[model samples]
Target: MGNIDKRNRLDEAPFRYAVTKTNTVFIDYEGKQIKVLKGKEAEKFLKRVNAADSEKELQLIMAKITGNFKRGNER
Candidate 1:
């Protein structure tokens, strides 16, 4: 496996961080990578982290964002 893969697997739990490339940014939760966020969306994500809420909330937010993305793409 690649180094990043090995590192992720070696840890007892997943890591969280914002991934940035080009003009996009997203939060990585567990092994899932989201890539449909910017500006206010990013601010909201950071606020979630700062609020010290559960991972479930983050997952829900990710799901919501993903859902919106899928819907938008379908149009």
Candidate 2:
């Protein structure tokens, strides 16, 4: 996780999330939608977000939820 922070500099918090009326979660990175969480997953994600202590922490959570976003090999 420290590596992730060092690589991405989540201090700027590039990740964002939105919840729908039906309790679905949409996670976005750099203004692009990347992942969706529904049912138990949505509930769990919301819990973690609500408990986040800071913007950087929230960004980390979102990044983890999005899985492996980039592997540094893109041309």
Candidate 3:
């Protein structure tokens, strides 16, 4: 016998989903859906994603999240 647990890990994700299969959208603090990326809007956000501060922040945050994964047995 084996103890196998099934859980939706996306519920445990720390980040928000910005881009889906096609459209790019995000929710604001007011809970309003904001579609500010994709098409012409992507140009505006490109600089931020490529900036030094943004790159450093991304590395730091992703490192913490990727390092926090746990196996099903450990859960």
Candidate 4:
């Protein structure tokens, strides 16, 4: 996870999430919608996001949820 933190700068804070009235979660990166969660998944994600201590931690959680984001070795 340290490597991930190194690759993803906390200063930039590239992840963002929006929750709808219908309990749907929309996860985005750099202004692009990347993942959506609903039902139990959205509930769980909301819980985790609420429990996150800082923006950096929240960013990491979003990155993990999105999965397989750029790892800096693409050719």
Pick the TM-score winner. Answer: 4
- Colliding residue pairs in candidate 2: none
List model 4 lDDT by residue over 9-73, tens digit each. Answer: 65588889999999999998888998999999999999999999888889888988898765754
| Candidate lDDT values, in order | 0.50, 0.83, 0.38, 0.84
**Pick by lDDT: 1 or 2, better one:** 2
If ranked by TM-score, best first, what sequence of candidates would result?
Answer: 4, 2, 1, 3
20: Cα error in model 2, Å: 0.8
Each prediction's TM-score against the native? 0.41, 0.84, 0.29, 0.85
Estimate, for each residue in 1-75, the C-alpha lDDT of model 3 and write its tens digit. Answer: 012113543334333325555545342212334334565555444444456264335433332333433454423
Off by over 4 Å in 2: 1-4, 70-75
Task: Give one clash count per candidate, in the order shown.
Answer: 0, 0, 0, 0
lDDT of model number 3: 0.38
Task: Give the distance in Å from residue 6's predicted Cα in candidate 4 to where it truly belongs.
Answer: 1.5
Candidate 3 or 1, higher lDDT: 1
Model 2 lDDT per residue over 17-74, tens place: 9999999999988888989999999999999999999888898888788978456531
Best candidate per lDDT, number?
4
- Provide the lowest-lDDT 10-residue window in model 2: 66-75
Which runs of model 3 end up more than 4 angstroms from their true locations?
A: 1-17, 52-75
Model 1 lowest lDDT segment of ten: 1-10
